[model samples]
Target: MAVVCSKADWFVTSCSTTLVALNRKQSGEPFVFDCSKAEKKPKESDGDNKSAGEGSEEKDSDRILAFAISASGKHVVLTDDHKRLVLFCTEPSWKCISTRWVVRRCTSLAFTQAEDEVFVADKSGDVYSFSILEPQKVGELKLGHLSMLLDVTLSPDDKYIITADRDEKIRVSFRRSPYNIQAFCLGHTEFVSSLLVPAGHPDWLLSGSGDGTVKVWHYETGRRLHSVDLRKFGLDSENTEKRFAVSRIISSPDGQHVAVQCEGFPSVQLFAVDCGTEGLLNPADTLTLPLSPWDVTFDSQNQLWVLLESEDMNVLLYQHFEQHWRLCDSECPELKRITDALQTQWHLFKDSVELESRFKHLYKVNFDNMASYLQKKQERLDMENKKRAAANGTKPNKKSKTESGAVPHSTS
Candidate 1:
């Protein structure tokens, strides 16, 4: 079994047979839940309305909350708490291809564009590159960072590997036979949270830091290009609170819009970068997603996918989020049902002395104008859901059929 504490005050656990979530005060007993309930249809009932046989367990149930896409975009990699990595497809028909186990905690993972190789980093600052086709170690890079590797990305040409460290450094190295250090990019004074290699940009490297700044570097020359001080944009500076961890940074496939995911309230900011000046100008758009999002991913259709732990990594699409948010705000009786259950679960583990006051504080009480918003949102979502359900037959969700505004490409 694997357990993780969530920001929403719940403990999520998963085993071979089930995924369970427990309120922090639930006396350490987790309530069994089904992750697939949000998706697939239930099994047909028996003659007397009885349930069918047990459901299959999630293959990657014990994996950490991280996500990975394959080089050819055909497969994805998932790693569990036990240090075992599983390879699967990117589609809903996820089929595991292979699995490997490491001796230490897995820090980061990357797959080559060819889908032929896989790279994994461990807490010990050692990176191992292996062949996905052959499933054998091909190369290993050792850096003396002493801290855990935070993120890793392969250059567009697949000839170099870049890794961010907890020590606030970006290490660049060649990817071939004599994989040696190319250069070290340094600027941030705190831990580097993430690294991105924008597609079609061979010389550019993007790094986000715990110091509340996102820096762009000239990878080959190790020259600092642009520094975006997130503090100036209203990020919390307190070290104890996670307000601006720069959890994720991703470039749209076309290399036009770069989406940066930050901690605290879980908002995604889309930025337009000017390559001529090598700096970030302003955000083209911004979206406030559900709170305490564990992972965010963009699908092949450019639609965003969010994974939350309300009941075992709830996967909600970005388009459905506004309506989903509305439901939790007001109107929907389901909101009351969810909150009541959560409160009861919390009180079960909390000290009764201050339970009443704590319940009022923890439970969501923001209902001012929420009712009006939910009313409007319900209509909008009903129209949308019906339209999508019609074409999709209640299966995969459909994105907007009409084209959106053109995204201007950013030059290298």
Candidate 2:
């Protein structure tokens, strides 16, 4: 899938197996790193890990499953479909520092506040911690959940490790002792898909879920600050059979603006974060794109960068001017070059994402057993009432209630 995110002057985007990073200081030159050609550290390749990490590049061998740039924007780490944990340095130059192995296929990646450690969360409900200072060292198991983890993030000060799962729960655990959970930000009725602890707001945490709502929580206390229902804005699920899923939630570098992207929708919803103590959410404006978006993010300059579905000229830069967003793709000199680079492998992203079913089995299938049981009980009551009247040698009245005061069953 195509994805874009930025911190400070660094602009990073990924498609298929290649991640392109463009620093404003290094204009016209985007650092493109392909994971297929990556090499493991010295003597790190052992016998047990030879099958997944070491192999000839097959179809979808190097496809990036999850990736994240560090808080300082100086490093990036990504896990591929082949179970390789690849880390890159960004400040001096975009270079792959390490390619480690994960026990299971990773679902999400996160960096500590110091950016010295990288956290890898897999679909098997386990999270592994890898050292950034010691790139060649193996990873250590940090924590695990009972259900599949969808997103992982840390508090601004690195005090707590927050994780969301397939079971509609957000767990806050101590970073030093993950087994000791701090709190759980509960109330989402479906799987939590994305999480964001906005910049400049250490106490606030923003979460998006398949329940079609965006909620704000005070991470330390696990108190819900506020919530916004996307359905009120007419942002329903494209699949009528399923509930709406908030695919991504991103914030501007200043945390003054938050944008929400729903799965299967071609539009982006923007929310203005208040300056008050509660940091309330107010609807700003919803911008509809021409095509479905693979991902969206905000640049450090507070401009929204949208990676659309189209292959050619897929990158769009929307400038917020005069209280509304205006198209200014031409003004961005790096867009054409980035689009040109992505065009070659656009089909790979399109084909792979199209075939992947993200939210197929998430909806709950409820059986109303109470109603069925009550119906059967009433029928039994009527049958017994009739038998008693027949034994008494008298016609039973249809409206007569039994000694138990149960209503007669309707047979129509």
Minimum summed lDDT over a 10-residue window in model 1 is located at 352-361
The digit string of per-residue lDDT tens for model 1 on 23-59 reads: 4333433454323232222234222112222222412
Expressed as tens digits, the lDDT of each residue in 223-320 for candidate 2 is 99999989877676454454768989988877788999998877899988897859598998998888888889887788888887776657787877
Q: Any runs in candidate 2 off by more than 4 Å, and if so which?
A: 40-60, 237-242, 329-331, 334-337, 340-352, 367-412
Cα miss at 344, model 1 (Å)?
22
Clashing pairs in 2: none
- lDDT value, candidate 2, whole model: 0.81
lDDT of 1 at 368: 67
Kindly report which residue pairs in candidate 1 clash with one another. 25-349, 63-80
RMSD per model, one decimal:
26.0, 6.4
TM-score of each: 0.58, 0.82
Model 2, position 345: C-alpha lDDT score: 51
